[model samples]
Target: MLNGCYLTPPEPKVITITKPVPILPPLYLLNDIALSHPPINTNRELLKFAVKAHNQKVLCNLDKAALRAWRAKYE
Candidate 1:
């Protein structure tokens, strides 16, 4: 009975918790726009095409800027 009392269980060990790694979101692809062909016929058509092209360019640039911002945040 004395020997059984002396045989005590061992102390519990300390467990260390590690920090989880950050996960990056998947990149989305942009679709290609159907551009107008050159003949352009009249001044009005040319102006319309020019404005549309400019808008598309601006949108593309915005997307690039957003991607850069995301990269900066992750890195």
Candidate 2:
């Protein structure tokens, strides 16, 4: 018994669109990983950690003016 079906590979010119991925600082990822794995069970602690992660992400993505503002705020 022979079943005939043609399978074609993807064309060399095919374009793949990927989602915009946020780039996080190494420090940011390390901090998040450290916080997320802790045995602490307090809502306040968790919220603090979330804020840190979000702020770090925002800082990573800031434009020139935003970066200046952030620097001014911190320094």
Candidate 3:
């Protein structure tokens, strides 16, 4: 009879440090954050929308924590 299990090297322990990320303020509250300046060659409107959405997602606590957890798990 042959052994099914194979000897493998032990996994390394990983240490992660987490920091609080600031949330994005409301549009009306922060006027400058509302506008985005993209390349002249590209579509300005689409870029503006995309930038706003990206900023909001980055500033969200749940979103940031979820992302951090996923990164830690994979890394």
Clashes of each: 0, 0, 0
Clashes counted in candidate 2 amount to 0
Predictions: Cα RMSD each: 5.1, 17.2, 15.9
Tell me how many residue pairs clash in candidate 1: 0
Worst 10 residues of 1 by lDDT: 25-34
What TM-score would candidate 1 get against the native? 0.51
- TM-score ranking from best to worst? 1, 2, 3
The CA lDDT at 59 in model 1 is 86
Q: Residue by residue across 1-75, what tens digits does model 3's lDDT show?
A: 455576677899898999866554433432223344455565777777688778775676455565565555544
Q: How far is candidate 2 from the true structure (C-alpha RMSD, Å)?
A: 17.2
Off by over 4 Å in 2: 1-40, 63-75
- Pairing residues by index, what is the TM-score of model 2? 0.30
**What does the lDDT come to for candidate 2?**
0.56
Ranked candidates, highest lDDT first: 1, 3, 2
lDDT (Cα) of model 1: 0.72
